[model samples]
Target: MIDFTKRQKEIMTILSKHEPITAEQIAEMLGVSKGTLRSDLAVLVMTGQIEAKPKVGYYLSKNMQKQKQQDIWNQTFVKDIQGVAITVKGTTTVNDAVISLFLEDVGTLIVVNEHNELEGIVSRKDLLKVTLGNAQATSMPVQLVMTKQPKIYTIEAEKTVFEAAQMMVYYEVDSLPVVKPVENSQALKVIGRITKTNIVKALIEMGSEA
Candidate 1:
């Protein structure tokens, strides 16, 4: 069953008792503005917990359990679903990076320095653009072809997978490096990586388990 928020439960209860109540009335009883309940009402309607009548008010749906749905990944932690990141030193040759990318079956590689701190990320597209016609460039360091620090997108281990997915879509990235802040420093330490594939696989796994 889908878990309802506290306010949503109260709204459901209000609807049950009132049978059909307007949004303004519900907001007044809850001591909040109707705008505050707008999203909550939308969710309830979409999830089939409640229904709205034109020129009328909202009513609790009769078949609540039939419409029940769970957002399994909404509150899931990135750390729980992330995969081990394939990493290379920034100084690693492009040729070796390519080999690692293929061997690991991953599209991107995390590039770090001796400290194992995140330096940059190199993707197959970046490598392809550089090594397409120029064979000699294969010996070049990955740092040259990598999208450097401050530009690389990363997520915290504690962040929800939903937030990670949002970042991926907004940034137009296939994956994100999961990171943890270093002690007393602004530097980020690579933890793992969350990819579109990882998210999909997790959804499948969670669904199967359920």
Candidate 2:
């Protein structure tokens, strides 16, 4: 099943009880302005959670809802939504890493060793925590604040996106490093990354096809 945000879930509940509800009604009941929910409504429609008619408003998509569950089960593999991975070296300084983070526009950066082997992960939170009390954050190595190996959560390419989504929800992470086992070696090589946005896009694409 597709993961629904708290507000989305509430909206769905409202629709279930009142079919063909107006967007203005949903927004009013949810205590948010109608304008702010445009994307949410679009996503709901695009993901096949709801059907919309310009004059008729929105209602739960009965037919697509049934197919959605099965689609989630059948579309197995993280590779389906994987995107090119972005990485930083363990030696990268906080200043440089911050610049890279903005330049790349990514939430997390995979840290690698000299051999391009996975070392750890540095997230925006990690950078913020270290920078809060330290004036020398610019010179400090990312390795100093990065979440180290054994603590990082990773997914193999073969794993289902459902499994990856579950991991994200459970771990409260925005993204996951996609890795693959190196033959005859104990190390895993980072190949790609999957984010919540990727999952949403995949769902919308599938819904469109459906």
Query: Where does model 2 exceed 4 Å of error?
Result: 1-64
lDDT of 2 at 87: 96
lDDT of 2 by residue, 66-157 (tens): 65556674575799889988899999999999999999999999998776778899988889889988888879999999999889999998
Whole-model lDDT per candidate: 0.88, 0.87
Clashing residue pairs, backbone N/CA/C < 3 A, model 2: none
For candidate 1, write residues 1-210 as lDDT tens digits. 889899999998787667578999999999999999999999999998999998789987868523321345565889898999889998899999999999999999999777779999999999999998899999999999999989988999898887898999999999999988889987888989999998888877765554
Candidate 2 worst ten-residue window by lDDT: 64-73
- Any residue pairs clashing in model 1, and if so which? none
